[model samples]
Target chain A: MKELYNLGLSEIDIKNIIETYPEIKDLTDEEIAKNIEILKNINCNDKHIRNILIANPYYLNRSINDIKSLIMKLKEINIVNINLLFDSNPFLLNRDSYEIDEYIKKELEEGKKLEIIVDELESNPYIIDEK
Target chain B: MIVDELKRYMLEYGFNNEDINKILAVYTFKENEILFFNIKKINTLLETLGYTQNDIVKMAKRFPLLYSYSMKNIKQKIKDMQKLGYSYNDVIKIIKQLPAIYGYSIEENIKQKIKDMLELGYSYNDIIKMTKQLPSIYSYSIENIKQKIELYRLMNISHILVEKATYLMQSCELSFARYMFYKNKGIIIDENNYPKLFIDQLKFKRLYGIDNKTLIQMYNYDEYFSKEKNVLIKI
Candidate 1:
């Protein structure tokens, strides 16, 4: 761990990082060195690694593959999180991609000038049955 | 420097005095680089033309290079014209002369309206409620009660229905009326499930033996239909 401190991190930074990431707190010197090497291999800089460790200590001892998996999960749940963000900033939400499609389909009939793509989804019996 | 060019462009474009002044008000001038002017006056003329201040500001900011010539002096000139009383159409002509103003987009206008409505004593929920009725109203001017009335007329909503819907929308917890109003004409309702098709309330009253006052009260109270538990005892 001391050899890995090539960037000369401050005592506060080390303490903060260790406090933030519980996994790093219990790691032996050899384990910390291994984790640092793994982090560097994954294109993560020391600052980023430190920030992530501080934010979620449990991820400190996790493999790079596990971290990548966590990010994938975040993207998978993007829609639900995006909706929550939209709830706070409705004006910023892009109407074209959001509920506008469903709104147009449910509210308007076929051949309407503004009929959204959702209308196509709803009108197609195959899709409905498949769903 | 750009002011001169804007003047030349305006002359080339065959803009009138009112229109030229409007452009001058919205355009700004840097003192050291060139003589500058306030563009706020142009805002009033744009207002008369039905263009919001935000829209004009956006246009000026977006097309600084294209409109740089007159942009500097346009703002002050617009303010002067407003003092004398110019129309918004005249102002919009100048705004049109400028390219795109990002700040004056429709989304910004809606936000401004929501802010104004809140300042005018509308509650957060009421503002949201009104938004449901007239979604476009968020972008358009809410000060124009006439437009609201016209929207109601266009929706074929009767005065009695308006009274009922208004009462229901305002007093009852139902937000469907607002949704319906925005969906159809901007008329709020007590319930979303209620038939929104154009059915004259007067005719309904005559046919159903329901009085206007009672209907209005019922709609407001969310008691349009008398279920056993929902019966309103006139105390």
Candidate 2:
């Protein structure tokens, strides 16, 4: 909780985060610290981490193994800017790796280039869910 | 600087980069030139007209061309719709549903469409309600709309149902073909299963053992091409 305050989340931000994902209120300070450490392991700076928490507070409730595997899957696809991708579309972090791979394959089958797909997924990850 | 400002404004309003690229395909920003239109002013005008941020986003997404129109043109378009007895909220609803309404002309397209619908035995109130339901009806040609209504009459589907399911006005040939198929199958398509008329072509084929091409030719051959007496049919 002190770390979230250190990240500069306002009272309203904290309140809204708790209201949206009430389980955060039940997590221990150490568990919250572990999640933040996992986010930093993915190269998210403090500001990017703050934006992710605000955009989708459910990330705080995600298990460390689930978060690590999702990051690894995204990295396997050569997504270089995982920080910006998750910061903009944190909900995408919840997607299974197979779903992501299938979306890429479907787009490639439709004659889209790999580079364009990766860039699109990074900037506008919503297109993956549209598949 | 104006180009950057415009890009920033569009991004803030939730227009994705792909949407911006599509818009840029139609309009370009010249270097070292003052812009003639202002997207910011247009956003302010729409907000002033009681459109919420999401409504404006949805409308612009539907018709990115609206961003290219000058503020004066957009304002006049809204006022013209208002003059037609549509309240501000009603106009907003129409625009949200059919943002291409911004591109239509007052004298030739909008008013003429309403007048044509009135001449087609639809009361003014009916026209209003129907347009509110399906503003794309404003863009449908009079001949095409008449063909749709006539097909509904032939199907024994009431104009009231057409008003409720205005999408029935979509493809006349497709509707006629579906109607004939239902007739041949001794199946009645009332309000209950009118939606089945628009089933996917693959599903329709799998269910009825008839594809779209065969169905159109089987039933709609004479009526579909009767307009061109000497034209060679190429199905």
lDDT against the true structure, per candidate, is 0.37, 0.65
lDDT of 1 by residue, B24-87 (tens): 5433334422433323333344456565544554343223222332333445444543342334
Instruction: Give per-residue CA lDDT, model 2, range B141-216, as digits (tens).
Output: 4544565666665555646543674553334455667776886788877766776776655567689898655675
Task: Write down the worst ten-residue block by lDDT for model 2 chain B.
Answer: B226-235
Q: What is the lDDT of residue B57 in candidate 1?
A: 43
Supply candidate 2's per-residue lDDT for B225: 40
TM-score of each: 0.19, 0.56
- Model 1 local distance difference test score: 0.37
Candidate 2 CAPRI classification by DockQ: incorrect
**Clash-forming residue pairs, model 2:** none
Native-referenced DockQ of model 2: 0.01
Native contacts retained by candidate 1 = 0.00
Return the DockQ of model 1: 0.01
